[model samples]
Target: MLIVSQALIPHQDGVTLHPDLFLWDKQLADRKQSWFHAADRTPAEWYASLQGSDVTALLARQIEVMPAATSQCWSVTPYHGQLMRDSIRVYPEGLFPWCSEDAAWLCSTLNPLLAEEGMTLLHSGAALLLSCRDALDAKPLSFAAISGKMLPNRHHEGADGGRLNRLMAEIQMMLHQQQPESRRQRGEVDVSGIWLSNPVAWPQVIIEKKIAVATRNPHLSAIVDGQNATVVISEAERLDQLVKGNVELPKRIVLTGEGYAVLLNRSLLPTFGKPSWSPKRVKSEVELISKLSGWIA
Candidate 1:
């Protein structure tokens, strides 16, 4: 079963690092204590690094002894009984061709940790908040788990090139056109610009994505459009039916096994509240990390 865990990024001095791209920048990695290299590190060494126990210790605190009660203690699903819905932001830097080797390694490392507790890491799409909680605030805040990096194995050539570029150009255009004030009133816009640009992009497909979530609870939506880039959930009507019907939707959803991680924010939760959706911004840092532990297990 998949569970949600949320962590806050340091946004000091009005400078907040985009969570998705935070690990992509070598400069930033060099200065911080990030597990961006976990995938490449041997499990023995990786587990050794968490010895002192701060973050990992916290993770340990959240663990539980299974019914069989063997040597392996595991974490209970973090979001299992939690009430609040999460809103995640997936940065472009986490896209293919942009993620670094270490980023991929990190993902490989973390996957097993999740699996130990009976969960799998998915190459899913997510979204970010179109407007910061504080309009005057320059720092980025995430309501969901931001995918820090992309899978380095994916390729960007061939027919996919056309769709990728179109989506990219469209995102750039929307970022340029949609201002904070405008988006506030309009709420959010679809991230169709990126999908339309990808080479092998085909937006009509829906492969286990969070098409909609209830707005009454505050959530974002994810969907596949005519283009393949994965659209952001900006409207709540799609989710409205779901809410009326009552359902449990993933906080972060993907259009395909190899698709973008689109996030749904409160503004569009209403549509997701019904049952469905897909939104935007400027230059943002992106990162991608894999779960190596899963591979080992």
Candidate 2:
């Protein structure tokens, strides 16, 4: 199976992509394709669905399970940013740069504030985990999904909708006040606020075999079962290296992008004797990329 972890760097704005950005252009042209982006979802969310989980619950199984069943757990994503005056848009530059010492310090400063809500920050194996004493049945958007967007207001629907929004607002205020002067002298942006994802749970065991993966994404690598081959992860740029000569590529080819994905395989191929609606064959580089990215024009 070939999982193009990021098949295309897509734009939600309907901007067309250059064909050169497409990977392995000629290699998999003859193979069939079936786009899997019928609903709105990030590539991460789509992959999570394939694992029998959703964006909110995958973390419960992906991260190490703590024995405590009374608390809610989350993987922390501390972002360096400035919330724009627009009141709804966050600077896209708010990407988190993980520095062990810096992250630890930030958590220490913020832990006391989190304690007011019965939450604690834990630095575990390169992951900043958030554990809460009360059950939070709300779904927090992934940072990837909201990179170009803004955090949802408290009115966003969920069981704990109001609290979720309030918590984010509080966190933002705390970060602004607690930012250190050293980082400022370096002309670095403030570690203003955070966007959390991978809401893991307590005491539930997910058993999957170790899988072989090839990618540079740390978050993507952490969730895979390295000891088994059930889940295969690959990068869009390295599809050619993943395929070999004389042998056909794996039947499952998942072309994923920012908020969409397409499943390509022989099963979706047009059959001579059968009559069914099927997407056209990938005859050229233009068609190949356009098909994978859901772009036309």
Candidate 3:
């Protein structure tokens, strides 16, 4: 099995992702396509599907898969605050570039509030992780899920979603109350909010001992594999290049994007007889995207 993260755009419209996205690579793209009908998810969800419970619970369980590994229990995201009228917006870490001092101070101020709800915030090596007195039933959205999106609406999700949503509100209020708006006006980065993962268990990941890993996710490399699969983790812009980099296909190649993943199952070995290009039907981008967009939804 091969897992390629960001294999497609989370919000792809009619346009082809890359020039050679599908038409140029029939061996992989047209092998046996299987698209998912579920809602979109963050790229990290695709990676965490590779690890066992121990490894997962051990990363809030996985942060856009996090800055570094830690034994700490609860995972948190240092949201780059972009306050809007009705809701807040979250930016990627690149815009904020969290500092140790900022993290420490934020923790110092927020820990007390967090303690009231049986939670503690700690600065764990360039990222933030929350520690809970009990197992948390609800977790915030994966940081990657909302990197440049509006904050998720207050939805009743998971077992303890009510409490989780309340906590998010309190944190946002705390930041704004602590002069974050002023700080923003002065052009300074502020950790005014945080996000956590829903802890998704990908029903899609195939457990194979003998496997080769290729990824941009920092945490998945710790996985101990034996050799039958080749997992490729790629950024949005580089999916085509990564696949092309390895012309040899595994028994199957799972190309996953946000909300959905497609399976391309075929023989692992390179074709021995007729070339894949013998009778290629290169459909116009319009035809392909029209059919694909339906299933992707």
Candidate 1 stretches with Cα past 4 Å from truth are 5-155, 180-182, 185-297
User: What ordering of candidates by TM-score runs from best to worst?
Assistant: 2, 3, 1
The numbered model that scores best in lDDT is 2
lDDT of 2 by residue, 37-146 (tens): 43333334444545445433444454454436335677666665545675556444213334555556877888888888888776543346677788687776666555
The sequence of per-residue lDDT tens digits that candidate 3 reaches over residues 1-297 is 455544444333421232335533556544645455323333334443443232334343323442232223554666766779987787643244444555567788898898777666765344456665556567555565566578788754679888878888888888777743444666787667777554433222333323355643333433332243345554444445445644665565555444445556674455444322111232343343344333323
Better of 1 and 3 by TM-score: 3
Candidate 1 displacement at residue 267 in angstroms? 40
TM-score of 1: 0.20
The deviation in Å at residue 34 for candidate 1 is 22
lDDT per residue (tens digit) for residues 1-297 in model 1: 111111123234322333433232232222212112111211111222223221112222222321222222211100101112452233322121211232233234344443443332221122111101111111111112222322112324545344333433444454344333433455433221121110111112222321111221111111123233221222112223222223433333211111222222223212212221111231111232222122212
The residue ranges of model 2 lying beyond 4 angstroms of the native Cα positions read: 2-20, 23-31, 38-47, 53-69, 82-96, 99-103, 178-190, 198-201, 225-252, 265-297
TM-score of each: 0.20, 0.63, 0.54
Off by over 4 Å in 3: 1-7, 10-34, 37-44, 52-56, 60-73, 92-106, 135-147, 177-189, 198-254, 263-297
Model 1: per-residue Cα lDDT at residue 192:
18
